[model samples]
Target: MNGDKAPVRVWCDGCYDMVHFGHANSLRQAKAMGDYLVVGVHNDEEITKHKGPPVFTEEERYKMVRGIKWVDEVIEGAPYVTTLETLDKYDCQFCVHGDDITTTADGVDTYHIVKSAGRYKECQRTQGVSTTDLVGRMLLLTRGHQQRGDSEYKVERSRTESMSEDSAAKSPWTGVSQFLPTTQKIIQFSEGKEPKPGDKIVYVAGAFDLFHVGHLDFLEKARAQGDYLIVGLHTDPVVNQYKGANYPIMNLHERVLSVLACRYVSEVVIGAPYSVSKDMMDHFKVDLVVHGATPVATDVDGEDGDPYEEPKRRNKFMLLDSGNTMTTELLVQRIISNRLSFVERNQKKEAKEANLWKAMNADQEK
Candidate 1:
């Protein structure tokens, strides 16, 4: 009893997308407020209900949150309904939320339950940046950019040049490309050709370039919370539009292979113009949508006389922060900063190897 009482448990929720430093700071502060932190990740459907549309899918969001270092446990559910029932289920003595939610109309804030339980607290908002701010900045930086097209053209030309000599060579795997899936046969061997039903699918999407361990962990966690995990892969054009010109290092096909290889992922669907289509979700019978802790919720319809609200279905969304880890942008920056050193080291090694080969050939001739 004394041991249980010693560790204070806290509850926090958000649609953690992009999983940036601001989100990490928030989770760090939230964890400092209590001994144990249980995070809630909002599903895609719930996000659509509240905020317009999220950039990354629920799985991507979950992965981003789970990657955070401060998060102790992740709960896949809606963010808006931080109810007493949930608090009781988790045995949470304290509820934590950002100071920003203090004036919301839905008086049903996290502090309300914590105060009712006699242990409510508000964590400080991470200063400087947010997912929204980041997205806005990216939009500002990459708007009307033609660099992506140039990069794509360059990479394609290089690939063609490399393959020019092998044009007559037979393809390795029948007619299929190296990046394609193993087999088109969707039937399972053990189940004996049973038609797979589109069950209660949970959809999540993102670019997912430079796949990392955090990405894997999030997918595993999100898949456990649902029946099927449908990952939405952003096409090059879509990524260029949303993420800007200097984004998506790996092409769409490569990104798909990286995600498809994950055990938690079931199917990878390409994203449309923007946001996951409600029709696609309905067609797939998507029961829930999952996202990270810091996802940018755009397409707010409140000011335009549209029925859709800014943050849709606030109650049904779950915002999770599992742990903070590596990001693609950070990785790229590191590589760029060390480019000269890497090149010099590689050049030295190649010269040494060539000299040794020449010496060996001379000895063989003698």
Candidate 2:
């Protein structure tokens, strides 16, 4: 409560497994609607019983949710169902969620309790992206989805055409529509802050797809080394050329938002060059260039040249072991190992959402 009126505290809860720009967008909207945003994350056991095995663990999900820039607070181990008691406890004026539906294993709406009490609000879901969609891409090893070229138009075109006639079969939960990104969306997610003078600016570059706890840990350590941390996200094609096998589950713009959402990131170089050059270093005034424990890859031309040669020659390069061994490859493998479960989860989710839409349409027609 600031200056006579009680501050609006909004409540948002979910499994938040493999938290992406979609989740961040929802939380961003939630924060915009209120003074404070309190996010509740359900535990792994609850999520497994209700949906299926999550790509990330409970602790990972908790940390990821907390990393979202808009989140004011995080409540770990939240119940699968949203209840008035929970809202009362958090002093949240109302609960907010994406327009999509969330249900338990028995196919009951998790938010029915809050909806009936008129304490639930819905924001439009970010289309064309979801954990299910990412898992599907990983399992299928689809490489045609990477947005090529620099312009936003090309990016949107690539993503839209990436979806085929059978996209429904690919990921029922997320559908085929590509996530339309605009300059405004990027501006919205940006911190809009400049590095103070004498601030040691640290620059790190990577694919950073499906941003997980490992990336978070590395960024945290990098930020600890300097006052400002800038993450250089390589273009989709560069990543695919190096990673191969349908790398970068999320496209460039998607990766931009994901990295910008992190509290540790002060700025992001969208579609940054694969090689860290001297011009780039001088331009950003980067004081230190950091890389995770994972060894840097050679140039994309199949040459023996190192990508970090400039940083190393300048003595600006520093290798930091975040102590977390998690990698994007490991994450993809997790989904692959549980391929059947994820497929079933997507099917059931799509069915439930389809039914809900049908029921809503019927009531409206009446």
Candidate 3:
């Protein structure tokens, strides 16, 4: 608990549905308030009663929360209605929440009881993001553009259809999502080890955003070229420079896990530099630096620039042909095309859950 600064245990509770960077950032803030951060996730029924069904199930939400690097502990099936009792049970000094207006089904402020008890703390809401905003991005992607009759969406959609058979449905997070990753698993995946003598270290960098089969195939081919593979993921802004217009649908953290889950990937460099520097090559003992058929980095003025400048200087640069043209743009278009399928899937899930909820309530009454 950070050298026992009174061992503050801070608690935060929420549905955390469709967990994303917004959720991650809030947990970060909550953890900053105390030594130990404990997250409480409400059950599906409680959420359904108050906030409607979450895109991901309660179990899914629980697992996602547990995976965030900031989370210390997670309270599964926490009560939707917070109480001093719950906070005391966890030894949590205060309950933390974003500065958003959250209300119950009856439009009552949910944190009233806690606020009245003088244990409520509010964290700044992450601007430009929310589960609702993300959901809208998927559902109403072609909204304003549709009204304006923009041709780019249609063009991208058609281009995506021609590329591959893989479909994007629901949130892309659910597509490549994995069970909670362990420290050992992460270390092993990241290859955070001293390289053995004669080990051929290959370095590659990109957004690796949606993490589709193309990424798998590309990594497989890259892995075949070296004993260790280090993938450098550019930051979101840098990715946007090349990807353009609502690209990198996943944030940097999400993209990290997505790439880490790849069997062929040895290690991932979070917020890796766009230009491969000599220092990086020396540190990792990278023998080969590879770039795929995607766009290379550009200078601030927008002219094309060498992404592998240091690698090139050291004669360690090479271009790889993974022969897979699939990209995140294509994946997004696939989702756009299969939009109705996902909507129907959600509808079915809601109906099934509603029936199950009714059955449980009836049994309780009996």
Candidate 4:
């Protein structure tokens, strides 16, 4: 209610399983069209019945949606189908989604009702990434996608170049695209705030691939420890060097946006050093450095001792349990274990989308 004229509330709903920067980007766009953004997350049962098994549970998906910076409210266990009644109940002026297909198991568009009522709008889908593509990368163990470092100049190059050449060979449903990153996009996602004086700035660093509930929980706990929480996002090459074997499913720019979108993050250090040096700590005015319970990967070449040595020496380091043991490795195993299901799911989804496009085009021709 802006001066008696109601605010333009926007509604966006999805399963949001394996939440990524793509999802964040969509939410950001949806929010920009209205004063308030209300995101509805489908539950696990509904998602499994309609879209196949979700990577994350309903509770996790709900929490992840709430964490997105642009999301003003979250409706848990929302219906798979968007109804005008749902919108009117929430007083939303319109609903929004990405320019991608979302259908039920019976090949019905989830937003068809809203579309028919002229209560829906579409935003550009972020290219080069999707849950299906990420699952395929895990199932195929595609190591070439990892960003590699050119030691001579300390520069990094994305393997997506080579991967793009072979894109024609891949299924349209699961094919990967080269993610075009821009400083403007980064600026849009960033909080862009400096820590105030007397503020305790807590720091943590990681690859944060997949950006699941585990990362969300860890960030929440870390944020509780300080006035401002600055996350250090390691470069893709650095993550690959440490994790080795098709690691960092998301690239550096992707990971940067993912971390910055989290509500718990006050700021992020892009391409942060793997080793937290004294100079680095002093630079951020970091009062404490926290690490999750997962075993720390050794330094890039193992030539440098422990990565946390500087923090340890300064007595500013603390080990956080986070309670949830989920990791990116565990996520890969989940995808690999259910490879056939996800593969079939992507194929069916693409087929349904193609059929819809054909029908729509035929109508337009008529």
Highest TM-score among the candidates is held by which one?
2
Residue-by-residue lDDT tens digits, candidate 2, 43-102:
999998988788888999999998888999999999999999999999998999998788
Q: Who is ahead in TM-score, 1 or 2? A: 2
Arrange candidates, best lDDT first: 2, 4, 3, 1
| Regions of model 4 farther than 4 Å from truth | 148-175, 362-366
Residue-wise C-alpha lDDT for candidate 1, range 1-366, written one tens digit per residue: 236467778888877755554455567777877788888888877754544355567877776677565678888865555667777788887677765542112223434555676666776654433443333323333322222355654453344224323333221111111222223311210112221575556666667765655566667667776777777777766666556566665556556545654556777775432454446655666666666643443532123231212124433234445465656666555444655443332233233334445555699999
Model 2, C-alpha of 340: deviation from truth (Å): 1.3
Candidate order, TM-score descending: 2, 4, 3, 1
Please identify which of the two predictions, 3 or 4, would achieve the higher lDDT against the true structure: 4
Clashes of each: 44, 0, 0, 0
lDDT of 4 by residue, 1-366 (tens): 468777899999998888888899999999999899999899888988987888787887888898898999999888999999999999998999988778788888899999999999999888867876666567667554455233411221123223333322333433466567899988988888899999999999989988888899999999999999999988887888888887887778778888888999999888898889989999999999999988787757467578999999999999998998889999889888887787676555555666677676799999
Q: Candidate 3 on 136-174: residue-level lDDT in tens? A: 446544332211233654553443323323332212211
Q: How many angstroms is residue 182 displaced in model 3 relative to the true structure, after the best TM-score fit?
A: 30
Residue 186, candidate 4: how far off, in angstroms?
0.4
Minimal lDDT window, size 10, model 3: 169-178
Decoy 2 TM-score against native: 0.91
Per-candidate TM-scores read 0.42, 0.91, 0.52, 0.89
* Predictions in order: lDDT: 0.54, 0.85, 0.68, 0.82
Alpha-carbon runs more than 4 Å astray in model 3: 1-6, 142-231, 234-247, 250-283, 286-366
Choose 1 or 3, whichever is better by lDDT.
Answer: 3
Residue 1 shift from truth in candidate 3, angstroms: 4.3
Maximum-lDDT candidate: 2
- Superposed on all Cα atoms, the candidates' RMSDs to the truth, in angstroms, are 20.6, 3.9, 12.6, 4.6
